[model samples]
Target: KVLRLWLFCQNVSFMAAGVAVVAILAYPDGAMAYNHTPFICLVVLINVCGALGSLSTLAGTILIEREWAVVISEGEHPSFLAKMNSILRRIDLSCKLLAPVVTGFIISFVSLVASAVTLALWNILSVILQYWLLMSVYNGIPVLSRRGRFADESERVGFVSLESYSGWMNGLVDHPYVSAWRLYLKQDVVIPGVALALLYFTVLSFGTLMTATLEWEGVPTFVIGLGRGLSAVIGIGATFSYPVLESRISSLRAGLWSIWSQWSCLLLCMGSIWVKERVSSAYMLMGGVAASRLGLWMFDLAVIQQMQ
Candidate 1:
């Protein structure tokens, strides 16, 4: 029931996002050339849509990939879980690499309006296919359907619960969202989760900051895109390598290896900071960031399997 409700909400949100994007591009003159009020309103609407899409994606990932994977792999050997996790990561990375290239090609050659239309259409159409796929998976897997409710009666509470709080301070601490964080913090896997998050926070990847910095240093767009593509390739390689390494050494050791390898590659980036030459520093920074993806992804896979 929860899954169905979430899926329904995501479908509505995706369609709304599509409509908002189309509306933005429908202007006769470009947004900046025309009145600012409508432009601001459209921007806010799209931002909200994007946020909702992100949340929906996150929720769907947790539901299908993490929870369902565990349910299906129950009583199976750990390698089964590892394989499932790796395959999903591989597909995810592939899509991440391909989607941008495809979209960029369209935007560069076709038109921005066309690209917006394509995006809106994709959001509208893909939701139907995604819903079908998810439902089919649930139906096909008997164990998934057999799984009982995760939340206990004790876990359920109103958003504003007067009874649970004995004092004013208790109310703040005992808030449901706060309680969820408290429970997560107590888990053994929290360290691995933190490690994963730290990797995300790092600037070594092909993030917007590094891309802008490289461009500012007079690096060509082609080189930047090439470096980003290479990073994706390296990350894909990690997905392949993780299973073999895990079979030899356990997940924990694999994680250690991956993290150390990432740190070692990132040394180039640190060295770049000290370089006197601007262009050289940018290239060095880009190289370090690209190479680090290998370890970063392997470490990511290792952490996920550990959690599972």
Candidate 2:
């Protein structure tokens, strides 16, 4: 339980950082530029960069977590601190995997903000390049195929099939679209994809009502906003619960990874929007949101691995 709480807190911290970055980028203005140019662009860029960061971060974290679990589960391993040190060491080494790309994003963001060149053009190009790079990494890795190297390692360690686990979960839960699907590979389950799509629509409907109808200044408005915000949190939390729970029970490595991945996405989305609203840049916000979603999808495989 300590480990679980610790991981959750860490996940929240990561997301908060993302949000802070976005907010910082937006603070140049009066915190209400939701219709401005720079703000929009910043929103998009943050979302994209954030998503990429989340995916890569999750992958690295999951890999290290699993490695740690294997070591600790052996029963004769070193003390807990030593095991943690081992994980940190591995994470440090793996930093090379994402540090360069993240650095590139930082450089690009700075360039766009500092230069007088057509900000929109540069922002668009940077987003495209960053997204392409992220996609390249996702495609290059066969981690999601359930027959890849990571999957093989998991299988050797008695990891369960994602499909089987999803099926079992669906059997127990009342929800329809909670089952697992790899990219486009939908299994023959009773829950139709359409029904699953409806869940997202429902969430969006609630978000829209909160943002559009509820005021934000008065006490009544604050209460409404708070409730709506909590609803959104619950929605996002629900999306991540299965992965977190399974990871805790089956493999702490996978759980941490999944939690981290979701945190990254949440950060990207929140940060990008915050930046856009502040700086008035539609491009940035769009880029950030798109990137975050793509990252989440790409990292979905690792989340599934936790159940195994």
Candidate 3:
């Protein structure tokens, strides 16, 4: 239960920290008016915030999903899990589409700081929602809150020291995080899956570079955000199409499509490196950005299908 609470807190805190970084980055003129050092630091801080938020959300969500998987499984309902999973994917895609475009519109029409403030307020609202849902669902109590769990048995487990707790958690090497890495090392199929993961994210790393380069180039924030948002909109179909793909083809086979799609489409943007015109280069970059995202979402679907 402590672990669960810690995860949830980290989840909220990560998001809060991320938005705070955005607040720092809401420079109206694109690049900061000050020295490059502060700008670089803020950029690095935002990247850190993004990584932390993503990892924490991934870990917490995976933990919760496994709990749900136990209670609601294919054994009980044939298509229920798949249907719910597809629905969740749709919701996630919808958010992805909405957030950026909305942010773009705000930054276009309003002050940069206003956009940040809006995001911050939304996150605060989420914190409240998160608290409400948790409290209602579990009575805001630990899982092992029953009398027996707190009973004065021979091995009383009421409280534990920090060091003891750390040791205990470390003892659970079979935990998902640990086991996943172990499986990746021991299993041959997992290597290609990992490679696929690497390839997809590596391509999408360009998205970060694209953001920085474009911001540096003085591209309007709204245009940059809109282009990225539209690309995500285009990729939604690809994301939701994975289940149907699994029905028709083997997951392993389908996963290869993830790799093939991006590498192929990205070829169109190869000339961006050599192009001198800022406008042409900007178009090329947008093409690469969109193509990169399209492949990534498909890779996400393939990963869950085959790797998991």
Candidate 4:
């Protein structure tokens, strides 16, 4: 079971790395040029890679559960079909309760590709904002922890010890399954998303600077190519940093708080967008967004400190 899980996790990691590579390679002139053929081919490849990666992860988890069930049901002479049916029944129940998990994976995969394409179009800032919102929701609420529920008759509010908290967090950090998710979050999701955003900004900044410095007909294209190269480098760097960042933040709850604060700021920005009309009015709204993102990070830090 451990070996299977490890292999599955490795496959997902490779797939994510491939996506990052593809994004870098399929830059404006190479894959996304207004020319139809290359763009279509690249798009198909991206979709295939992402879909396969997600399915593999999902399938691996299901298999692990099945194995556990089989072990626990020792000596039961259930037929293959009966076993399959039993598994499916459990899956159905899970799907009903956790419908959003499936949806979240799908959305995350789709948005990743879309963000890459958007960056190709030189819409960097917009792509960044879109991903920031999506991931904030993914990591902050449903994925990291479940919604808070009222305490029940059997449940009591009690002081949790620092030692206990440390042990729990350490187990989460050391466990392969938990580590896989953390790697996915930091390397596959956050890094790629941030790289795309940075690429967009880099291209936009270059274009702005060049427009100010010199006259050119194809400056945007130049910016796109340069940004793509930079993004590739960022992707590579992120791959290397994944373990380091995970180790650093594993025990530090501050990082989680930062994420939460950022999410709150994101919500504020969304609300501001709905209420404010004028461009001039967006400054305060933008501040709110920054504050929220910062707040999440702070909250994560606080949690880590408490655990410590």
Candidate 5:
């Protein structure tokens, strides 16, 4: 019930923000000129919206993918959980590839105002659909309603009086966010988790910087999008390969192999640094990143499964 209510609020917040942003930007004189008051306000508003959207996305993913997934697969075999995770990741990757392409197409062919209006309408519809789907899932799964609240109730600490503040400090230290990090740090799997997290910080991937750099080096937009699609497809292949590898070797061994393979493939990116030709270097970098997705996803699956 808490998760459902939170999701409902998230959808409402997202929809309201989306509508407001669209309305502001779609106004006749809403050009974001440098010295305009409205432009400054709009910039601040956009940042707020971005922060809200990011928070909502992270919360939703944790609630649905981590908590609800575990509840749904409570009594099922391990493979069931693996399959669910794979499906979730595949859908996420597909969206990552498709959303940008579709948005780009709309922005290129249609007016900016048209794209904004389209997105505003889509957000409204998506809010309704998302709430309906969440409610349906909640109704179908009785255990989910009882899952998170009761298990660790005793561990929740109360605050102390203002004089000493010891209890307050303890409560802060024992808060779920802090406690989660503490627990994670204590676990053997922390190494792999850190390794996975580090992947996000690198520019070797086909991220925004890399994409812009490739384009500046004469690679076409279509080629960059094609590379992104291919990378996603290769990443999806990890779902199939992971089970086989884990069955042959242990999960930890599979993870080790996967991470090493990713590192090895990244040698192409390193080699790109020494290449004299700009276009050839860009292609080399892109190819390395695309090829690395296979091992990246494999390692991701391995670490996630291990953590679960």
Candidate 6:
């Protein structure tokens, strides 16, 4: 089970590296030249690679959180599991914020192909680190301790988990023992999940295009990078307030409020794009972007808490 989980995590990140490496090879002009066929191909490949990586990681997280949370929280005080999950969420948020800054800094200094190569090397090292970590810390990280591998929780979350949808159709469908919707997707759960997912998709999927739009409006690359970094900083800062908000209202309610707020900010962000050739317009756009991230993080914490 540990090996399977590791493989899923490994492939997700490894294929992300593949996405970058493929772009380096397939893009005739740099990625900046978006109107070309190769660029379109790059975008399609990236989305596909990113989706597979995400699905695998999500499956791993489900297995870990559901099965291992009990293990970690056992004999612990109230809210211990919750707080640990929060820490994990914050770690993911930090990565989202820092990645663009790191990538931009590298791209600013290096050739495009060189930067892609660097990204690929980074992912390779990450895979090696993951294995080393599995040996040293089991599945759990070594946050503040050094101890048989902390704990692995190597048991499968369930057998159904190992089977991909394609395999499920081929093997599980209509078999005497088979079932439909073995895992129920309740409407309440689905709605917030979709909302949270769409927010993430909007920010991530249109990111390159948004940057390009800013460039078209005369924004410098470093300036755009700075803006993204700022957005992340704002998101991180907003996370600290989630507890306060949850205390005042239900988590789902707080999440709904955040979703509404983000849409409002998105309108303002769109408006900023029309302010052509003005220096303040760039700042305006940055402000909008930061607002969106703030709403996003707030809603993210809220929904996840409610789900848990």
Best by TM-score: 1
The list of candidate 6 runs beyond 4 A from truth reads 2-55, 61-71, 74-78, 110-113, 134-183, 201-206, 247-250, 270-283
Error of 6 at 241 (Å): 2.1
Between candidates 3 and 5, name the one with more favorable TM-score. 5
Ranking by TM-score: 1, 5, 3, 6, 2, 4
lDDT of 6 by residue, 118-159 (tens): 766776677677667654644354432333342442232123
In candidate 3, which residue pairs clash?
none
What lDDT does each candidate get? 0.82, 0.41, 0.62, 0.42, 0.78, 0.65
Q: Score candidate 2 by lDDT.
A: 0.41
Per-residue lDDT over 1-308 for candidate 4, one digit per residue giving the tens place of the 0 to 100 score:
34345444435444544555455454666434556775566567656766765666566454444443343334554333233333444444344334334434544777555544433343234335644653564455442233333225113422233365576686665665764455445442455345334423431222345343322333344443433334333323322332244445542343454455455655654665465444423433434533442233233223322221
Please, what are the lDDT tens digits per residue for candidate 1 over residues 228-288? 8999988889989998889889889999999999999999999998999998998998888
Please estimate how well model 1 matches the true structure, expressed as its whole-model Cα lDDT. 0.82
- In candidate 3, which residue ranges exceed 4 Å CA deviation? 2-8, 11-54, 64-71, 76-83, 104-117, 131-180, 200-206, 215-220, 274-278
Sort all candidates by lDDT, best to worst: 1, 5, 6, 3, 4, 2
Model 4 residue 46 lDDT?
58
Give the clash count for each candidate. Answer: 0, 32, 0, 25, 0, 0
Measured by C-alpha RMSD in angstroms, how accurate is candidate 2?
17.1
Error of 1 at 11 (Å): 4.8
lDDT of 3 at 279: 69
Best by lDDT: 1
Per-residue lDDT over 1-308 for candidate 3, one digit per residue giving the tens place of the 0 to 100 score: 64356456565655666565665666445556655666677677666766776776666556544343333443544235444455656667788678767877798899677787776677667767766775565554445233453244223322233354466585665365665566456655676667765764554433667778777776776677767777877677765666666556655555677667777777767768788888677777777767766666666656653433
Number of the candidate with higher TM-score, 1 or 6: 1
TM-scores vs. true structure, each candidate: 0.88, 0.26, 0.65, 0.24, 0.85, 0.64
- Pairs that collide, model 1: none
lDDT of 2 by residue, 123-189 (tens): 4455556456544644564343223434443233332344654665746442323322232233332
